[model samples]
Target: MESFSLLLRGFSVALLPWNLLWAFVGVVLGTVVGILPGIGPALTVALLLPVTYDLEPVSAFIMFAGIYSGAMYGGSTTSILMNTPGESGSMITALEGHEMARAGRASAALATAAIGSFVAGTIGTVGLTLAAPLLARVALTFGPAEYFALMVLGFSTISAVLGETPIRGLVSLFFGLALGLVGIDLQTGEARFTLGLPQLLDGIDVVVVVVGLFAVGETLHVVSRPHHASFITKVRGWTWMTRADWSRSWKPWLRGTVLGFPVGALPTGGVVIPTFLSYWLERRLSKNPEEFGRGAIEGVAGPEAANNAAAAGVLVPLLTLGLPTSATAAILLAAFQQYNLQPGPLLFVTNPSLVWGLIASLYIGNLALLLLNLPLAPLWARLLEIPQPLLYGGILVFATVGTYSLNSSVFDVGLMSVIGVVGYFMRRFDVPVAPAIIGMILGPLAEQQFRRALAISQGEMSVFLTRPLSATVLALAVLVLVIPSLLRLLRARAAHQGRP
Candidate 1:
C-alpha cells in the first residue's frame, strides 16, 4: 500500500509539463542519435550530462530515461532500411530486418521491430516498478560496511566484464577516479589533483568529459573510417506486418523480454549475452529453420525486443543498487551522482517519487518513440544518403555548440579537444571507453563506502566478512573475478598437453 501510493505520486511528477517537454526533447534527440551511426546512447548521455545541471533532478532523470529508451528504438530504422546498425543493440536486427527489407517487406520489418519494442518496453517497466519496491525494502537495512561491500562488487564487476583486458579496464577506471578526485576534497580542504589550474579546481567538468569522450571521441572515430557509405539493398513491401508475422512474433517478444531483464540487471556485458540468448532461442524454435539467417521475422523481432528490453532492465540495478549492468548504465549512474543523488537501498526511502517518476516516464518515452518513429523513419533513412564529410562536419558542430552552450566555458571546449585526441587513440588500441567512465563514476563512491565501512569497524578487515550479507556479496565478487581465470588456466593446460 505504501509503495502503491508512492507510485501514484510518481505519476504526478512524470506528468508535469516541464518534464514532459524534456522527455520529448530527449526522445527526439535520442532517436536522431540512434539513427546516426556511431553516436550511441552511452556517448550521447555522457555528452549531455552537463546540460542537466539546470534541470530539476526528477526532470533531468526523466529526460535521461527518454534518451536511453529512445536510442534503442531509433537504431532499428537504419538496420531495416540500410543494413547498418545505428547502435550495437541493432546488430541482431540487421541480420533479419535487412533481409526483410531485401524481400520488399521493409514496412513489416519496421513495424514488427517498433511494436515489439513497445510491448517489451512496457513489460520491462512493469518489472522495474514491481521489483524496485521489494528491493528497496531489503536495501533499507544496509549499513556502511554493507554499502561499501556492494559498491566494491559493482566496481569490480563493471571493470572485469567490459572489454578484452581487465588491466586496461582498471587503468581506465583509475583515470576516471583520478579525474573525479580533482576538485576540492569533500572531507578535507586540500585540493589534490588541481595542479593550480583554476578549471582543475572545480574538477574537470562532467559535461566537458562527457562531450569530449562521446561526441568528439565518436567524430574522431568516424573520420578515421572509410569515406563512403557502403552499398546496401533497398527495402520493399507493405508498411505493416502481416497476420503471419504477428503469429510468429508475439511469443518470442515475451521470451526475449523475460530472458533480457535478469541479464541486464547483472554486471555482465549488458545486452550482449541476452541478445545472443534470444537469437539462439529463435533459431532453435523457428518452424522454418533455414529461413533464420536468410531473414525470418522472428529473428528480427526477438533480439530487437530483447535488446531494448535489456536496455530498460539495466536501469533496475543502477537505480536500486547503484550497480551499472552496462556501459550506458554506468554513465546514467554517473548522472545520478552528479545531482547529489545516490541510488541504493536508501534511495527508495529518501526519494521514492524521483525513482518512481523516472520509471513511469519510461513507459511514456517508449510510446513517444513509437509515435515519432512510425511517421519519420523515412526522414531518418534519407539521412544516410548524405556524404560522410558533410555529415561528420555537422556532428562536430552540434558537439561544439552543445558543449559551449552549457556553461560558455572555453576551457571546457579545450578539454573536449584533448579528450577527443585521447579517445581517438583509445579506440585505435581497442581500449574501451565505457569502463573508464564506469570507473570514474563509481570509483569515488566505492572508495568512500569501503573506507567508511572500515572506519566503523575500527580498521578491522574481518568486518567485511563478519556480516552475513556483506560476506556473501564480497564472496560472489571474488568468485566472478577468480572463476574465469581458473577456467582459462585449465583450458590452457589441456591445450598444452594436446588433449581434446
Candidate 2:
C-alpha cells in the first residue's frame, strides 16, 4: 500500500508537462538510434551525457529511462525486417522474426513483437516497482565487508558471463581496473598511473571512455568493414494480429516476463541469457515445435518479450545495490555520478522523487513505445536506408563535440581518440568491452570498501570471512569464477574417457 501511494506520487511527477515532452523526445531519439545498425542505447546515452550536464537530474534520468526501454522496443523492427539485430538482446528475435518476415508474415511478426514487448515491459516495470524497494531495504543492512564481497561477486559474474571465455572477460576487466587505478589515491594522496600528466591526476572521465569505446570505436569498426547489402521485408496485409496469433502469444509473453525479471535482477543475469532461455522454453512448450525454425509467431513473441523484460530487470540491481549488470547499466551509473548522486538504498531515502519518478517514467515510456512502435514500425524501418558514411560521420562529430565539451579540453578529445583506437582493437579481438566498463566503475568502489573493511577489523584479513553475509557472498563470487572452469574440465575428462 505504501508502495502504491509512492507510485501515485511518482506518476504526479512523471506526468508534468516538461517531463512528458522530454520523455517523448527521448523515446523518439532512442527508437531512431535503435533502428540504425550498430547504435544502441548505451552509445546514445553516452553521447547525451555531456549534453545533459546542465539539465535537471530527474528530467535527465527520465529521458534516459525512456531511451533505455525504447531502444528495446525499436530493436525488434530491425531484427524482423532487415535480419540485423540492433542490439545483442534482439539477436534471438532475428532467428524467427526474420523467418516470419521472409514468409510474408512481416506484419504479424512485427505485431506480436510489439505487443509482447508492451506486455512484458509493463509487467517487468511493475516487478521493478515492487522489488527494488525491498532489495534496497535488505541492502541497507550491509557493512563494508558485505559491500566489498558483493562487488567482487559483480566483478566475477560479469567477467565470467560476457566473453567467449572467462579469460577474455577477465582480461577486459583487468584493463578497466588498470584505468581505475590511474587517478590519485584518495586516502594516500598519491598519483599511481599519472605518467606525469596533470589531467591524469583527476583520471580519465567515464563519459570519455564510454564515447570512445561505443561511438568512436564502433564507428571506426563499421567504417573499416565492407558494407553488405541487406533485404528489408516490407510490411504487407493487415497489421493487426489475428485471433489465432493472440492465443499463441499471450502465454509466451507472461512466461517471458516471469523468466526475465528474476534473471535480470540477479547479479549474473543479462538480456542475452533470459532471451535465449525464453526462446528455448518457448520451443519446448510449443505444440508445434517444428514451426520454431520456420517463422513461428511464438518464437517472435517470446524472445521479444524476454528481451524487453530483461532490459527492465537490469535496472533492479542498478537501483538497489548500485551494481550494474550490463554495459548500458554501467553507463547509467556514470550518469548518476555526473549529478553527484549515488544509487542504492540511501538514494531512495535522499531522493525519493527522483527514484519514484524515474520508475514512473518507465511505465509511461513502455506505453509510449507500444503506441509509437505499432503504428510506425515501417517508418522506423526506413531508418535502415540511411547511408553508412553519413550515419557514422554524424556519430564521429557528436562524439568529438561531446568529448570536447567536457571541460572544453582539446586534450580530452585526443585522449578519447587514443582510447577509441584501443576500443577498436578490443572489438577486433572479440574482447567484451562491457566488463571493462563495469570494472572501471566498480573497481574504485570495491577498493574503498575493502580498505574500510580492513580498517573496521583493525587490519585483520578475516573480516570478509567473519561476517556471515560477507562470507556467503564471497563464496558465491568464488563459485562464479570457478564453476565454468570446473565444468569445462569435467567435459574434457568425459570426452577423453569416451575416446573416439
Candidate 3:
C-alpha cells in the first residue's frame, strides 16, 4: 500500500507536461538511434549524457527511461528487416524475424515484436516496482564487510560471465581497476597515478571512457573491417496480427517475462542470456517446432519479449544495489553520479520521489514506444540504408563534442582519443568492454568499503572472513571464478582418458 501511494505520487511528477515532452523526445531519439546498426542503447545514452547535464535530474532520468525502452523496441526493426542486430539481445530476433521478412510477413513480425515488447516491458516494470524496495530494505542490513564482499562477487561474476573467456574479461576488469586508481587516494589524500597532470586529480570521467569504447572504438573497428551490404525489407503497410499469431505469441510473452526478470536482476545475468534461453525454450515448447527455423512468429515474439523484460529487470540491481549488470546499466549508473545522486538503499530513502517518478515514467515510456514504433517502423527501416562511413563519422564527431563538453578542456578530448584507440584494440582482440566499465565504476567503492571494514576491525585482516554474511558472499565469489575452470579441467581429463 505504501509503495502504491508512492507510485501514485510518482505519476504526478511523470505526467507533468514538460516531463512528458521529454519522455516523448527520448523515445523518438532512442528509436532513431536504435535502428541504426552498431549503435545500441548504451552508446546512445553515453552520447546524450553531456547534453543532459543542465537538465533537472528527474527529467533527465525520465528521458533515459524512455530511451531505454524505446531502444529495446526499435532494435528489433533492423533485426527483422535487415537481419542486422543492433545489439546482442536482438540476435535471436533476427534468426526468425528476418526469415519472416523474407516470407513477406514482415509486418506481422514487427507487430508481434512490438506488442510482445509492450506486454513484457510493462510486466517487468511491475516486477521492478515491487522488488526494488524490498531489496533495498534487505541491503540496509549490509555492513561494510558485507558490502565489500558483494562487490567482489559482482567483479567475479561479471568477469566470468561477460566475455568469451574469463581470462580476457579479468584482464579488462583489471585495466579498469588500474584506471580507477589514477585519481587522488581517498584515504591518504595523495596523488597516486596522475603523473603531475592536474586534470587527473578528479579522475577520468566515465563518459569519456564509455564514449571512447562504445562510439569511437566501435567506429574505428567498423572502418577497419570489411564492409558488408545490408538488405532492408519494406513494410507494405501498417499490419495487424492474426488470431493465430496472438494465440502463439501471448504465452511466450508471459513466459519470457517470467524467465527474464529474475535473471536480469542478477549481478551477471545480462540481457543476452535470457533472450537466448527464451528462444530455445520457445522452440522446444512450440507446437510447430519445424516453423522455428522458418518464419515462426513465436521466435520473434518470445525473444523480443525477453529482451525488453531483461532490460527492465536490469534496473533492479542498479537502483537497489548500485550494481550495474549490463553496459547500459553501467552508463545509467554514471548518469546517477552526474546528478550527485548515489544509487542503493539510501537512494530510496533520500529520493523517493525521484525513484518512484522514474518508475512511473517507465510505464509511460512503454506506451509512448508502442505508439511510436508501430507507425514509424517503416521509416526507421529506412535508417538501415544509411551509409556506414557517414554514420560512423557522425558518431566520432558527436563523441568528440560530448567529451569536450564534459570539462570544456581540450585535454579531455585528447584523453578520449587515446582511450578510443585503446578501446579499438580491445575490440580487435575480442576483449569484452562491459566488465571494464563495471570494474571502473565499482572498483573505487569496493576499495572504500574494504578500508572501512579494516578500520572497524582495527586493522584485523580476518574481518572479511569472520563475518558470516561477508564470508558467504566471498565464498560465492570464489566459486563463481573457480567452477568454470574446474569443469573445463574435468572435461579435458575425461577426453584424454577416452583417447587412451
The best candidate in terms of TM-score? 2
Point out the higher-scoring one by lDDT: 1 or 3: 3
| Local accuracy by lDDT, each model | 0.79, 0.90, 0.89
Distance from true location, Cα of 268 in model 3, Å:
2.4
How far off is residue 9 in model 2, in Å? 0.9
- How do the residues 351-402 of candidate 1 rate in per-residue lDDT, one tens digit apiece? 8888989988998998888898776666666766777678778777877876
Question: Candidate 1 regions off by >4 Å?
Answer: 165-168, 232-237, 405-407
Q: Flag regions of model 2 displaced more than 4 Å.
A: none
Clashing residue pairs for model 1: 104-236, 104-237
Which order, best to worst by TM-score?
A: 2, 3, 1
Q: lDDT tens digits, residues 131-199, model 3?
A: 999999999998899989988998998889888888888999999888888889989999888999999
Give the per-residue lDDT of model 2 (tens digit) for 1-500.
78888999999999999999999889998888778887889888988999999999999999999999888878888999989898888999999999999998888898899999999999999999999999999999989999999999999999899888888899999999988888899899998899999988998888788888888788788777888877888777655788999999999999998998888889886788888999999999999999988999998899889888888999999999999999889989999999999999999899999999999999999899989988888778788888777888888888889889887999989999988898999898889888999899888888999999999999999999989999999999999889999999999999999998
Worst 10 residues of 1 by lDDT: 229-238
What's the count of clashing pairs in each model shown? 2, 0, 0
- Judging by lDDT, tell me the better candidate of 1 and 2: 2
User: What is the overall TM-score of model 2 with all chains considered together?
Assistant: 0.98
Instruction: Note the residue pairs that clash in candidate 3.
Output: none
> What's each prediction's TM-score?
0.92, 0.98, 0.97
